[model samples]
Target chain A: MKKETLILVTNDDGITAPGIRNLIEAVRPLGKVVVVAPDSPQSGKGHAITLGSPLRLNQVDIFEGIEAWTCSGTPVDCVKLARDKILGRRPDICVSGINHGANHSINIIYSGTMSAAMEAAIEGIPSVGFSFLNYAYDADFTVPRQVAQEVTKKMLETALPPHSLFNVNIPDVPLENYKGIRVARQANAKWKEEFDERRDPHGKKYYWLTGEFSNQDFGNDTDVWALENGYTSLVPVQFDLTDYRLKEKLEKEWQFQ
Target chain B: MKKETLILVTNDDGITAPGIRNLIEAVRPLGKVVVVAPDSPQSGKGHAITLGSPLRLNQVDIFEGIEAWTCSGTPVDCVKLARDKILGRRPDICVSGINHGANHSINIIYSGTMSAAMEAAIEGIPSVGFSFLNYAYDADFTVPRQVAQEVTKKMLETALPPHSLFNVNIPDVPLENYKGIRVARQANAKWKEEFDERRDPHGKKYYWLTGEFSNQDFGNDTDVWALENGYTSLVPVQFDLTDYRLKEKLEKEWQFQ
Candidate 1:
């Protein structure tokens, strides 16, 4: 008999979120699942790790019979702990998110959901982060559940490109109406940020971050285009941040002392 | 007379830390500096932004004549707040850190210092993050101070490539022994993580995350190689995480349904 596939599942929406629960149900049949996730929401936490504080992890019965632990750390910490403490070895593959919202385009820069998967990718594990375009707590996971099942199944059987991870985003559409998945590029887009200034009860001023998503690229091959066209967009993500084109430009044209 | 070059300065080691103080002094002569930074150390905060909580900023006089503000947020949040609130306009360039530790290679992925600079780059500002290979609270800033002045002068004179940010890692060496700066690539590296499990006074177990820096690549044109050779490593960093090379490989090799 073949060895059972070991799967690690985590999310940024805390352990109790409907999103991760949906994800667990969708992928449990694929392999033995172990979940280590943040005990509280870590939505805007990028690739943060806890250095100044000690972390606590407790085994919980939150997912019924699933082996799960709620961790007091960032999404990345959850993955680290899962590898070091829970698994005692690398999991066959790591899957993060089924995030509460879309992590498309430049939003990936600030996404804890994507960061967790990226951490696993850095560890040379084939990993994928799944997100629904919907942010609602009650957003029907009917579409993402099917996408997760399909993607997780495919990932189990196939090998991803070396050092490359997947950012799988399902468009918020009825499952039957969804078009097929498209491998796409991240669109050149950004949040046009605005600060909402408000006063506390003590009259101290504080600011809340708000933004509008602005896609400046019209590339038909981009994730924005795929999502807008009713397809599940899959973008290959990596952790190398070097701009090779600009490196050449800097070397020849700019002088540094 | 030249218009005063507006410079935004921040760090992951917090406003009162000696490292940020060194950074402020180094760039003092370059421009009209506006210092906005976190109130406490946020060492492992990557590109995180505060979304679940409100942010508070207060004008501070800690740097004598330098205009500064202590922010109740992460390093990335300081940059955003600097742009929209404190500066009330985009600064000519943003410089983050004479960080308390190394941010070369994989450390950059978990670095709050690099993230602050990355955030500024995302907002289209020419930016750089500087770090010492030293992580001590009282580490000598003699080398970094001179390097900072030189890099700041050079950046003000030359426009960096569009959307380009620099990650500069200084060797923890004497200024006179310093070799020339090398424009390099981020080396392949990762922390070999170990979790020290210990029991609390109340008998609950907790973990302290610890890691040993492990450099895997033998490439000479890497940041790690540069630092080991007594040269400051300058890697032109970008926020785009798409693995184009792998994207191509995946297209030709992997079949998706």
Candidate 2:
């Protein structure tokens, strides 16, 4: 019997999105595919789990030739559910997104796409989150498939670092004109959050979230630079949030009684 | 004239929670306090931000001395909003939470309390997140006052490490019996996520999120250990997710074209 690879699939864009459909199509030939994704889009859910309320999981038939389930929880919930209840066994690999928007720079801190991948990595499973530079309802995902396919193939053959995962973002370019891949650092970019204040029909004041992406780091070795240059950006990410350099200094300065 | 200190205040337990009110009381005398927080409870929202829709802000007269506003967003959003819209200048200090529960070990990843502080730290603001090791709707916060005051004063007097913030969890003991503070590391502990399946009144199956906290770490210097020993735990955390030790190995193994 061939070593059947169990590829756990999920996304923040919900199960019915074209991105996951494309992902499922590409990875179906590789091995056994199991998709546990949110029933609705969970774009900025971050590392959130479903603790506030009860979660519901229903068997979904959104994608053919793949075992699928829709979760009434965040992206992290999908991964947790797949690992504990659905798979019950350790999966060979986990892949999240082909997200509609970029999970680059500071955006990673708020991305449901990267959080799903981070959840898998925290569980000691090799995982990757693929995203696009474009943020639209129907952004082009043509170039993403080829890059995503190649990256997935490489990971299936070789293992990633423990407690580490990839935040891969592809430029919104055509497949034919796309440059290759680039291993880069997360760019020091952030959103200058500006809310668009407006009034509802009932004259109730409301605000819409808006922001301008500001890239401060002009280094060529960053994911933002790679995306701007039309290359596939792969930034190695980890879950250890400790500021190790500050640790020793703090220990020495602060008196612990 | 006293130098007008810009203080940014936020919380995970919603803007109306008693926790933020207690926090506001502690910090109001020290600076020009600006309270921007979620309209509803966002306890487990993590580092989430609103990406799909616009965020709303409502000016509410809650706290008497502090300038408070409720945001239609996550805890991280409150920080961002305060940074951009509310504060006239860059905040001298940012404080999140007098949280109802502990943000010990890996729980910080899914904690909106810590995330609000982490967001400010990323923006180069001196930040601290204060939590008590108790989970109750009407938990007593008296024990945390001295610890919170000390940490806040220290951060104010001597600026904290850039890209670093405090994750402070006070012991749940009485004020007199509480052991002193401890400079600690995030314990290598995690929630063993378990889902409790039950049938809804509408005849559909639902699952309640349940987890048992597992701490296999035996190190005395860990946060969990400190908290268990009746000490307040302060762990300095950062946003750079790079595992630099593995960088050289990954660079050699995986070549990016």
Candidate 3:
């Protein structure tokens, strides 16, 4: 007489992405699977919730046994809809993405994949967002599945800290030659952005947002370092954006009227 | 002769809101003001950047003496636009809001006001987002203006920590009654959300998002506690979401492959 593990699954790379397909195949064996994700790709959507318009949910059959639904909303909306309308009960664990790209360091702030997991974590559900270093349309995720399953299984056995969740990024490697997992902090990395200016058909100008990932932190404890050293990086990410040490410093040092 | 300070200004309640107008008035004397803000309201926008579509910009004469441009995008877009398109050089300081509502704790994650400031901080500009607890259209600005000026003046003189910005929340008190500013940490606070299900004009069920603020942390060191105590709260917020302590703990303790 034990409670069944209700795992709420989602992704930012759309429901049709092979990443989610791989994720669904992996997690289906462990729990009652409910796949609720965006009907189309919603990468880099951040922590956006659909408040300006009506969100529509369409019941779709993407995975064979999984009760799947595609949402015309962001990845966070999928979790919201699943919590409100789709899921019969509150899910025990929420797993978002086997995203087609890396969502490490500052990228996690702008990632719809991790945002979905953050949403679940906010609701006190244990969650993790999985991403691969590869950004290809058909990236190999065979190795990441084992990493995801291992982490997901561990979280299922023991609850994660409610204030935080995992942002897991796997290095781009074939399954046979994949390195092991590494628990590390997110690297102090950033995207050095440059907007590519281009002219449209109507002779107007537009910009394509482009950026280079810059990592200055040489710490071996970072997720970036782990990935570089041939390992699946697991960064414990949190929603609390406060810098506690700086707070005390400001209080003691700054002049206040 | 001192180098002319470059100040980048933006808001969440649209470029034309009374809040931003008041903000422009306050900062006009301090430096070379460059206003780049959303043409429309972008509340609860989180950290959204315009990636899918081409961003549009329109020059405006709203702020009289200031060089201003309206962006057909989110608040973050306005900051990015200002950095890439409008600004003659990198801004020395970035100031966001005079928002009519408080963005104290968990609210910072969903605030367009703070996101704009955070975007600037990511680009290495000394930045702060000012907000008042009053959520009315014509909330009292007498208090927020003073705090904003103080914080801005201080940041202009002294550089803030890289990748860090301030989340300044003023109390909804009269200027005379205010207890002054207090550097604090973001409280462990959240909204107790309850969806009000209503019938739309088309006889379809819809939900109006409604929530009540809940402050779980009672410590005086928190932003919420400072606001409640009639002190202007200044929390140094960082964009990096990594939980470093948990990383060490997981690495040493957790059973991982």
Candidate 4:
């Protein structure tokens, strides 16, 4: 008999969040599922790992009959601890998030959800991060759940390039209005950040980070375009951050002594 | 008269670290410098931002005459807060670190140093992240200081492509042994992680993250190779994580519905 496929599930949203629960339900049937995720929400944690402190990992009976562990660290830390301690061996595939909000465009860099998946990719595991457009606690996961199932199934069946992962974002639409998934590039866009400055009771100033994502890229093949057109965007992502074009340009034209 | 260049300085190392002080000194003569950095060390913070709570920014007099602020958040948060609240306008350039240790190869993704610079790049500012191979608190900054000066001068003189940043790693060598800078690519490498599990005073188990840098790629043009060969490696980096080749391959071969 063939060995059972091992699937590691995690998210930036706390393990108890409805999003990860939906993600777990979506991929549980595909393999022997194991979950190691943050005990609290770690949404904007990006690719952070806990370096200065020890991490706590305890098994929880949150997902019935599923081996689930809660970690007192960021999402990326959950992946690292899961691989080094809990799983003991690399899983067949790692899936992170049916995240509460969209992680499309430049949000991937600031997203703990995508960063967890990216960390798995760095470890040479085939991985994917799924995010829903809606940010509400009671946001409908019907569409995201189905999308996760499809993407997770395809990811398991397909042979992806090494050190690569997928960023999948589902549109907030009913099943009837759902457009098929589109293979797209990351759009050139950014958050127009504005710090909401307010004084505390002690009259000391504190600031809350707020931003509106402004997309200026008019490219039709970009993730923003796909998501705006009501399609679930699937952008193949990698960990190599080098800009080869600029490297080549500098090599030819610039004088470095 | 030409307008003074407003340079924003920051680091993963706290505002008081010798690394950030050397960085501030390196660029001080080149522009009107403003320093905004973490109040505590945030070494492996990557691209994390403070979201669940508000951030605190307080003015500091550690760097005499040079304006600086200490933020109660990660390195990336320093850049965001600086741009939106502290500076009230985008700085002409952003420079992060002369970090205490190497941020070459795969370290960039886990580096608070590089991520702070990356945050500036994402905001459309030209930026550079500098790291030395030394991990000592009192590591000699003479060489890295000179390197920062040369690179900053070149960066200010040239017209670089927008939305890109540089990751510069200096070899741990004295000035006499230093080879010139080489524009290199990020080496494909990863940390071979081992979790050191121990029982706490309360008899509860906790784990410390430990790892060894493992480099398998033997490419001569990689940053790892440059550092090993006694040269400072300068890699032009970008935030777009999309793997276009894989995206094209999946779009053509895989069936997604």
Best by TM-score: 4
Q: Model 2, which residues run further than 4 Å from truth?
A: A1-3, A136-140
Clashing pairs in 2: A208-B54, A209-B54, A209-B55
Question: Candidate 4 DockQ category?
Answer: high
Order of models, best DockQ first:
4, 1, 2, 3
Candidates in order, TM-scores: namely 0.97, 0.94, 0.95, 0.99
Taking all chains together, the TM-score of candidate 2 against the true structure is 0.94
Off by over 4 Å in 3: B198-205
Q: What does the lDDT read for residue A196 in candidate 1? A: 93
Clashing pairs in 1: none
The C-alpha stretches of model 1 lying farther than 4 A from their native spots are none
Task: Tell me the alpha-carbon RMSD of every candidate.
Answer: 1.4, 2.0, 1.8, 0.9
Distance from true position, residue A50, model 2, in Å? 2.2
Ten contiguous residues with the weakest lDDT in model 3 chain A: A155-164
Give a tens-digit lDDT track for model 2, residues A1-257: 86689999999999888888877877777789999999999988899887789888999776766799999999999988888789978888889988987888888988999999988888878889999877776877778887778888888887665666888998988777789898888888777777777888998876667878898999998888988898988888877676767878987787644
Model 4 lDDT, residue A111, Cα: 91
Q: Model 4: per-residue lDDT, tens digit, A1-257? A: 98899999999989889999999999999999999999999989998999899999999997888999999999999999999999978898999999998999999998999999988999999999999999899998998999899999998888777777999999998888888899999999999888999999999999999988899899999999999899999999988889999999999988877
Worst 10 residues of 3 chain B by lDDT: B203-212
lDDT of 3 by residue, B156-213 (tens): 7775577669999999987667899888888887765555667778776655555678
Candidate 1, A113-158: lDDT as tens digits = 9999999989888899999999898999998988888888887787
How many residue pairs clash per model? 0, 3, 0, 0
